[model samples]
Every structure is written in C-alpha cells, then in structure tokens.
Target chain A: MATGNISHGRILSIQSHVAYGYVGGKAAVFPLQCLGYDVDVINTVNFSNHSGYGRFGGSRASAQELSQIFDIMDQNGLLYPERLLTGYVPGAEATEAVTALAQRLRHRSPKLIYLLDPVLGDSGRLYVSPDVVPIYKNALHLATIITPNWFEVEVLTDTKITDAVSLRQATQVLHQTYHVPHVVISSIPLKSWLLDLLPAHLHPASASASTSEHLACIASSRQGSSSTVYATCFPCLPGYFSGVGDLFSALVLAHFTDEPTTEGETSLSRAVSQAVSKTHAMLVLTHEAAAALPEDERTVTDEELDVREPIRKIRRMRGRELRLIQGQDIIRGTQPIEFRRLQAWDTFWDA
Target chain B: MATGNISHGRILSIQSHVAYGYVGGKAAVFPLQCLGYDVDVINTVNFSNHSGYGRFGGSRASAQELSQIFDIMDQNGLLYPERLLTGYVPGAEATEAVTALAQRLRHRSPKLIYLLDPVLGDSGRLYVSPDVVPIYKNALHLATIITPNWFEVEVLTDTKITDAVSLRQATQVLHQTYHVPHVVISSIPLKSWLLDLLPAHLHPASASASTSEHLACIASSRQGSSSTVYATCFPCLPGYFSGVGDLFSALVLAHFTDEPTTEGETSLSRAVSQAVSKTHAMLVLTHEAAAALPEDERTVTDEELDVREPIRKIRRMRGRELRLIQGQDIIRGTQPIEFRRLQAWDTFWDA
Candidate 1:
C-alpha cells in the first residue's frame, strides 16, 4: 500500500472543463499540480464557462466518448493511476461510465485512493440528471473517501438532516451501510437552532455572534463498528464562488495521499483542517479581488436586477470567479494561512 | 494598454490535451499557471496519451466546435484575454480558426501579446496536416512573437539555412517581410561547418568537444529597419522527449509577457535566456528520472530492436514523460537552475 512518494504517483481526475473560468478540472487540476501530482484529466464536459454564467457554450463528452478514452489508455498501459478523483459528471450514462472506470482502477491497484466528490447538486436542488442519483449511490462502496455537501448527503442517504442527530444518522448510513471508509461533508451552513443542538465546544467561534454566518465542515473515518468524526468551522464569506468545492476535494486528495498509510481520525482531521484552511484563504482572496474590480465590471445589469437573479446580481459572476492564479503561492504552500484547525466532534455525533 | 500586473492578466491558450500524459496544453497550462497567469485553455485535441506513444485515443476538436467555444466566450465577455498563445493545432481548418481567434483578440485588446508557436513539425518532418503550412504563414503577421524551430523557419520563409548568414536571412524574412516583431528560432543543431561559419563567441563550449552534441536557440527582435539577435547554447542531453518545444514556447510567453512594455532585444534576450535555462534544467531532470527507472522499464523490446526503432530504443516512453509534477518548484521559480545565459549575437546575424 505504500508508494514511496505520493507526488510521484499519478492521479486520474475525471471532471468537467471550462475554457474561461475555474470549475471542475480547471479549478482542481492546477492546485493538485501545485501540490506536486501528475494529474491525468478526463474532461466529461468541455464548455466555454461554468453554467453559473447566464449563458455558456460547448458539448458534453458522451459515455461512449469516455469509454474510447479509457480504451486508448488501456492499450497504452496508461490507465492505472495511484489515485482516482471524479467530480461534476453531467448525466446518468456519464456517471455510470465514471463508476465503471473507478471500479477498473480499484481492481487494478487495490490500494487506489478514490476520492469521489458526488457533485449531484447544491442548495437543496439536484442540478444533475435525476437518473444519476442511483448510479452515484451504487458507486459509493468503491470510494476510499467521499466528499459530499450536506444536500448531497441527504439525497444519497434518503434522510432529512434537521439537527446534529439526523446529520450523524445520515453519516452513519454512509459509513456503516454503504461501507465508505471515510466521508468528508464539504460544507454545512449552520442555523441558530442547529448550532444550539450541538455541544457548546462544537460551535464555531463566530456562531456566538451570528450562527447563520458560520460554515462548518465535518470529516469522519469508519473503522469497523465505530466511526471517528471531526469538525472545523469558519466564518462564511459573502460571495459567489464556482470551484471552491472542487479545490477542496483536490487538496484533500493531496494531503490524504501524503499520509496514505494512516487512515483514521488523525489523518482525516489533518487533511480536512489543511483543506478547510486553504479553501477559506482562497475564498477570502476571491472576495477581495471581486471587491477590487472596476465599478463597471462589478455592476449588475438591469436585466439581472429585473429578474432578481442571485448569480447575476453578484457582479455578473465576473468578479466572483476563484482567484486561483493570484493565489498560486498559497496553493504551493509558500504563503499558507493556517486560518482554522479541526476540532474533535465525536461526542456530538455519538449523543 | 497598461494592465496593472501581467500575472493578473488572462491568457487564452489554444493547444492539445492528453489525458494520460503531458503534451500540448497538459504540458503548457500547468507551467503557465505555476508562473502565475490565469490561462484559459481551448483544447484543440483531447487524447489519452501523446502521439509519441505510437497509439493514441480521443478526438480532435473541430473548427466549428472551436468557433462555438469562441462565440460563447464572446457572448460572456470572456474573450478579451490580455495574452493569446497558439500551439499544436492539428489541421488547416483548426489553424485558420486559431488565426481568426487571434485576430479577434488583438482587435479587442490592441496591446495584446500574442505568442504564436507554429507547431507544424520537427526534425525535418511535418507532423501536422501539410495544408496547415499556409495558414500558419498567413497568420504570422498577427503574432507579436513567434517561436519556431529551425526546420519550421525553413518551411515558413522558403529558405535553406546552411549557415548563420542564411539563418539570419530567413529570420529577416519573418521580421522585415512578414512584420513579425519578435522571432525565436527555438533550437539549432550546429554542425562543425555551421559552427565555424558563426563568430567564435556564438559557439557553445561543447561545440569544441563535438559540434553535433550542442543545441542553440536564437532570439531576434525587430524595430523599424534593424533587428537585434541573441543566442544561447548548451550541451544536448540524450533522450526522446515529447512536449519540449511546447514547454519552451510556454516559458517564452511567460517571461515575455512579464516584460511586455519593452518589446525589443533586452526583453527578448531575458525571455529566451530564462526559457532556455529553465527548459535545460527540466530536461536534465527528465533525463535523470528516465535513467533512474527500473531496469525492466528502461529496456528496449526485441520487436523494437528488430525494427531499429529510435523511439522504442530510448526506453518505454513511460520513462521519458516530462517530470513536470516533480519539477513544480522549478516551474514556480522557487528552485531555479540558471543553467545558461543569452549572449548578444548581432554580429553573427549581421555577417
């Protein structure tokens, strides 16, 4: 199971690609490369920009196209990667293709660390085709780790997460039922009532001031009958960001792979803490960069205002793109900001 | 015309992408991003591995598809990149599309820096569609800078460069006749006779040991009637390397854009010197990595021996892939190897 250096190992990242802005592979690939990974990217959909823009152009790579790429790599002895990262597959057939590919990769290298970011949708909606839900659900067992936002957790587990208890219940389903070795719920926006349900130590420092403003991320590792969970919380920045989740998943893969042999709470905590801290730093930079843009570039158009659109009103979504290029130093670990540390929250989940 | 920082500027990079290996955009994009440019990539071809692998999988992005991407970017106001880089377009139609895109970009940003790498062929053979030659020729006037290998210069200017004088004559055709302000003949294999034809200072030190063992790159910049030229020479390493030319072109774009205002010999000299030096360092690392592979991985197959195949004889192409992931520090300029320096060779070109 030990590869001498994880950086020397290759990562097969199947994700969407956009020419204009960061999302999917465009967001994830550079950061992984910055952290020293030879990333082999399979672009599921190549577009002009992420769909957050009111308009976008380009086509999705069909399931057949995905198989064609896989066949060629197989022929050339290039199909095996030490790590597999799948994000943002747009349809059922594509999602199935990704799952099959993951199975093949895992079969070839039993030690493969498959980090599946189940990008079904966000904000209580399923942006992906409904048919893909079962496909992702079936694929969970193949993953070494899964990074799902709370909405995705609810969708996959078929549970309503209203409080700490229900949230842990859903996580338990993923761990005990599905047999996912580790699960990292990427983000959780806390409400006052939900914050109060948790023990006081589990609360984000900012939750005392305004609970709704705090975002917390939970990481759990399952070992036999019991599971270990940890949480990190930070004040949420107000802005639209396209690839923060993709970046977070990529960084987690990097850190987790760096400590590949260690698979329990400590490894998960360190990986989640570093990823959360780095993502927060990038988001803060993105928000500030948007604020620094010229008034004209940062203004909402009358059409957007008329529709009362959230995306367009946030400065045409132009000012809101992730500032990955400017934050290269941070990604390279040269100028890292250790903004937040993960705190053990096993008690909250147990209670 | 004044962009606050070149790094903050967006670069529209059109190239090929291989899923399993580094070549085209896979090779160029990460290095450029490491250098801190927000590179928006339009992949002209997406393949499983580079063509050097003898077998490949995937499809070329069509000219119409390229146009569709451009239209969407245009509609979204994402087309006005401060820098435009064109490389390794596989067809006449795609090359024409790239030229049109470059024209549109320059039309929008009159001060845009367009670095065009006419990736037609290498080693006296045309790897791309032969019909693409004229399109690249027609597209030359739109380029702010062009990086062409010696073979490409012969094809473009319709001149045989047997000696330094003929080489300069061909460079003059690109500069004065074609209105290309900056021309970099990326690599020159100096024969003993050709080396003698040049002034002594222009010769690489390794030239004295074995003239054929050294490689040199020439950079030239034109202003009105006169053009200034600089040359850097280094010992050639033994290896079958893919994407070395692509990497060279990308580094030139990064350094030249970093010094955009002064677009003459000094800037061109610094750009080419840094590019050549950095490329040399990466190549040295690549060669060492290939040599360090397991003996079985580095052995030539009997079938290849029967055919006397140059590619297979060099070891499995696996050993030869660019170590870009491990060389991230070098790409980031954090661990630079200033292996060579550019020398003013105006006299050699003048003679």
Candidate 2:
C-alpha cells in the first residue's frame, strides 16, 4: 500500500457541503488545500448549516445527479485520483453511488489509496439510515485506510468496546474481517493503561479523570508480520464540535500522502501525532472564541441550562461553531502545539 | 451601504463549482475562508473542469434544486448573510432563482451588501446564454457593488468602450441608468495616458503595446456628490487564466466587509489596490509554474504550434490551470506584493 515520494497528487473527496458551518466537505477541503493538495470535491449533500445547530436546511444530491457528475469526469478522461476520501453520504442510494464510483476509480488507478470515515453516528447512536451501515461494511474491504470513531468501530465490528482489550479486538476484527490495511480509531476514550504510557507530567490526575480525555490510535498490519498500533491522546475540549473528525482525517491524509515515505518522521505515529496536535490547537482556539462570546450570545435553552455536566452546558450554548477560518494559521502549521504519543504495542487480542 | 468595523461576518456565495480546476466557487471559497470569513456557498453548476480546457464535463443545478436548498435555509431562519455574492450562473432559470433569492435576502436584511460579478464574458464575447444579459441588467439595480470587466460594462450599458473617456461615460451610464452605487469595471483596456499613470519603470515601451495592459477601475457615485473613479494597472500576464476574476471579487468583498471603514487604508482604493496586487501575484505564480513544466507537457496543437505571437503561443501550451493552492500564501497575505494606485479623477466623458 506504500507509494513512494508522490507529492501534490489529486484527491477525490466525496462528502457533504454546508454553507454556514464547518462539517464534512467544508471541514476537509480547506485544510487539505492549505497543505497544497488539489482536492476535487463531490458533495453528497448540500446543507445550509451543520445539524448540530439543532436546525439545518438543504437538499441531498440524488444518485442520478452523482452519476451524471461522474460521467462528465469519466468522459473527460479525468478519473485518476491518487486518493479517494468518503465522508458523509446521506442515504443508501448516495452511499451506493459513492461505492460504485470508488470501485471504478480503484479499478482505473490500482495504487489509489481510499480513506473512509464511517460517519454513521457517535456516542452510542446512528444518525444515518440503517441501510447505509451494510454499504460501509462492504466498502471497508475496498478502503486502504479506515478512520472511525470508537462508537463507529464498535458498530462496524459488532463488538462492545468496553476497555482497551475489547478496543484492540474490534480493530483486529476490522483488519481480519474487512481486510482493511490501516485502521485509525479517532476520539477513542482513554483508559488507565493508555494514560500510563504518557509522561507523568502530561497525564491528568486519576482522581479527576473524566470522559473528555481521548486517544486516537492508528493500527497497521502487513503480511507475515505482527500488527502494530500506536496511539496519541490529547485533552478533548469540553463541548461537542461538529467537524473535528472531518478535519482530523483530512490532516492525516494530507500528511501521509504529501510526505516522502523514506523520511524517518513520515511513519504513521508521527503523522497521527501531528494531526492530533493540530486538531487540539484548533479546538483550543475555538473554545476560547466561544468563551469570549457575549453572555447573551452564549445563552442556552432552559433544558440545556439545567444540565449539570459542564460539557453538556457548553455544547448547548449558541454560536459555538468551530472557529476554523479564525484558526487558519494553526492549520497552516505556522502556530504549533505539542501532542504526546503513547508507546506502540503489538495486537494482544485474539484474531 | 457603509457598515463599520464588523469582523468575521458571514458571506453567502452563489457560484459555479468545478471539480478539477480553480474557477468560480472553487476559486472564491478558499481565499475568503483564509481571510477569516464564514462563507456559505451554493454552487450554480458542478463541472469536471473549467471550460478553458476546450472540453470539459458537468451539469448545472436546476432551478428547483436551488429553490429546495434555499427553502431549507429559509425554514431554519438562517437568511442573514452580511454579504451576498453572485458569480457565473449559467442559464436564465438559475439567474432568476438567484435574483429572487437575493431580493428575499435583502428584504430580510436591509443592510446586506450585494456584490454581483456579471460573468457574461471577456475579450468582447458572451460566453453565457444571451438571455442571461437581460437578467443581469435587471439584477444590477439590486446590487450594492457590481464588478464587471470592460466588455461586460459595454454589454450591460449598450455602448462600446474604446477610450478612457468612453469608459467613464459607460460607468456613468451604469450608475445613472441601473442605479448601482459602486461600479467596479475590472480589467479595462489601458490607453497611453492611463499607462503613463503607472510608474515609469513598470511601463512597457509604446512600440510593443497590445491589448494586454488592463486597468482595474472602481467607480463610486454617492447621492448629492460627484462620481469618483480610481484605477490601478498591472501588466496582464499573457494567456487565458480562469478564475482570476472570481478571486478578485472574493478578495474585494473580504476587504470591504472585514476592514474597518474608519481606517484611512480601508477606503475603496486600498481594497481595489490590494485585490489587484493579490490577483497579479497569483497570475505571476501561475505563469511561472506553467513555464516550468516539462517541454513535452507544454506541447500544443498544430494550429497553436504555428502561431507566431508569444502570448498566443503561451496560451496554447497545455497544463495552464491556475496554481491556486500552491500559491495560497499570497492569498493569506504572508507574501506581500506592491501595487501602485493611479490618481483619482472625476468622470470626464459626457453622457
């Protein structure tokens, strides 16, 4: 799966495009472009804003429309995309169209790297149609890299990820069952052992540990070799962000594709570390901007106001969209933040 | 029309989105976001590539689809866009739909600043359908700022723009006839006097003068006051470049809406000068990149190969798409380019 020294390659990104907020295509395109990749976006849905706002408006692109767009590209002999990225397709029909498009593109460019972010839902829920899950389960075999949240990993593998051991088992099932070469589980809830891997000074006190600490783990397996998994954890901001996963996946893709494979720091660990650091920096900036909003502007509904959890209260506040544009410097890597990497371990769960 | 010191306002951008090339929405969205504005984009057409390739693929968004998308936004109460920008609508139906959308948006928010880039054609040609012209003429009255090339100004005002005098007359007619307040006639063909207005060292000799030198002129007519026009000239790089106009309009809108009106530098002259400088910088970058391509990659058709004109020869060479993402630092204003402003003058042509 390793392609050597290809820079400035074209990326075919299929996702949703929102007019008012950062999510899906809106979240991914700008950051990838900032990293100097030519991104071709096929929007699965066009929405007025991210649904996290409690209100959103837009229409989904029909499967026929999607096919028509692809036909034009096919006719023009422009089908070779070095990487194909699938984000948020709304329904079963769009998902099928995207899968067919990806298969066709893969057939044309055999070395093409496909990264699928299985955006079904998060936090024990499914936002997309149930029919879409089967499509993703089948499409996982075609993906070179699969980025899913812990919940999505659980859903896809039909496993309960209660602890670190179960998480490892789920990843093993993903690799063995779907033949996915690389799996990156983003925003995974950190456990005690994972926290112990970090330097003592960076780790939060166990007494005050909350659900806000997260680790993003990247696992890769090769034939005739043991699977190796590396993880990096950063303190998650105390709120729900609409597009953090989208942004993180884009940054990882850009780093993994743009950097020379021969470089020592171009390993998966280093790329994940950089991606986590940037995502953390952006989150910090967005949180700060939200905190600075006028009290009236940050007002929440009565139901939200009664919530005791600080994270919940923060999530319900109005005008809490990610400050992506305001934090462009961080995306450009002009402003740097530190991220701590955990020790790499061999897969211990049975395959 | 004057709104002061509003930072990070939202912009509603209606334009064409191309998958493979930087033009229309593809060109405008990133730069505006880089400038720290929340941009909501409604793509008028989705194409495989810009038409400059001599052959391309794509489909236009139907009026019903546009209305459906807008309906969602309207239902969600997300209609207030600080600035509304229209670019590259392909047909009469889309034009009418956008006009109605703009009217509804303006009625809801009277302070909305509408900037219309009448992308009819260039170099004395009409690339869009003839029916679009009448639509544009009617829509012009609704725009606060109208950016048109000299050719478009001629078409809209029904007058030929031969000299600086006629150019002023054309703009005057635009203001009085259409009631547009701020008329920016981008890419006006420069005469000798206008060329003399540029710094002497930057000027080319009279013997080699062609239709390549263009002045970007901004004309403003406020009530009970004389019309004032300011112009700046940059040597237009040879060859057809797509999306320069779109990029220019986005930059202008960003500067106008983001910068503090009270600051001396935030005047219309400063905005136009900065926009032109950035556009020129990008053009220079693109031309250099095109020139550096391998000779085999620069091969052209037999008809193009026989052309003796250097500009024509350069235009015919293959692989000439704007290197926008590579040159994004200029858009971010990290690499500064200097542009000189010509003296301001009152309209001198008789109506």
> DockQ for each of the predicted structures, in order?
0.54, 0.38
lDDT score of residue A36 within candidate 2: 75
Tell me the spans in candidate 2 whose CA falls farther than 4 Å from its real position. A1-7, A191-207, A211-225, A257-266, A295-318, A346-351, B1-7, B108-110, B191-225, B257-266, B299-318, B346-351
Residues A158-272, model 2: lDDT tens digits: 9988765676678778888888877888776666665544345445435465624655455454333346666545666665777989998888787674445443333565666
Q: Candidate 1: lDDT of B39?
A: 93
Model 2: lDDT of residue A12: 92
Model 1 root-mean-square deviation: 3.4
Clashes of each: 0, 0
Error of 2 at A69 (Å): 2.2
* Tens digit of per-residue lDDT, candidate 2, span B1-351: 211112377899999988776899998998888777778899888777777655565567888888877876776555678899999987999899999998898788778888899999998889999998999999888898888988999999998876656666677778888888777877776666556444454344353656356544554544443465665556766667778899989988877644455432335666676678788888898888877887754555455444543333333433676777777767767765665553354333333
State the weakest 10-residue window (summed lDDT) of model 2 chain B. B309-318
